[model samples]
Target: MRLDKFLKVSRIIKRRALAKEVADQGRILINDRVAKSSTDVRVNDKIEIKFGNKTLIVRVERLMDTTKRDDAELMYSIIEEKYERDFKNE
Candidate 1:
């Protein structure tokens, strides 16, 4: 799936446009490298999102076109330490 779509469908960024904008601004990374909105996301890939004062790191567990709110949570696993580290450094 596209990184922007995946983020929205997985309920990570809440909106596709926001995902695209953030990605275009180089605020999103895949496998630790800057990623664009069109970046392909696959299972097991690591994603990091930087937003002003916060950062989120998640391991892609699944790539779905659509999912229920509850099921969406299963799409990725939060890496709290990594997230916290990035946030702290921000």
Candidate 2:
């Protein structure tokens, strides 16, 4: 799946437009490299999202065309979370 589409379908970013915007802004990384909104994503890949001073890292668990809200959490596993304080240290 496309990174932006995966983010939206999995409810990671709430909206497809927002996901695209963030990805275009270079705040989204795939496998530790910045990725465009149209980047292809696959299972087992690492995704890093930067929001202001917070950074979220997750590993892709599965890819699905359609998913329920309750099942979205199963799509990825949270690998790391860094808050404002943690970002400052990095």
On TM-score, the leading prediction is: 2
**Model 2 per-residue lDDT tens digits across residues 11-75:** 89999999999999999999989999999999999999999989999999999998999999999
Clashing pairs in 1: none
lDDT of 1 at 86: 50
With candidate 2 superimposed using the best TM-score fit, by how many Å does residue 12's alpha carbon deviate from the native?
0.7
TM-score of each: 0.88, 0.92
Q: Model 2: which residue pairs collide?
A: none
Overall lDDT per candidate, in order of appearance: 0.90, 0.94
Candidate that scores best on lDDT: 2
Q: Give candidate 1's total backbone clashes.
A: 0
> lDDT tens string, model 1, 1-90?
999999999999899999999999998889989999999999999998887757888999998889999999999999853323455547
Scored against the true structure, residue 83 in model 1 reaches a CA lDDT of 27
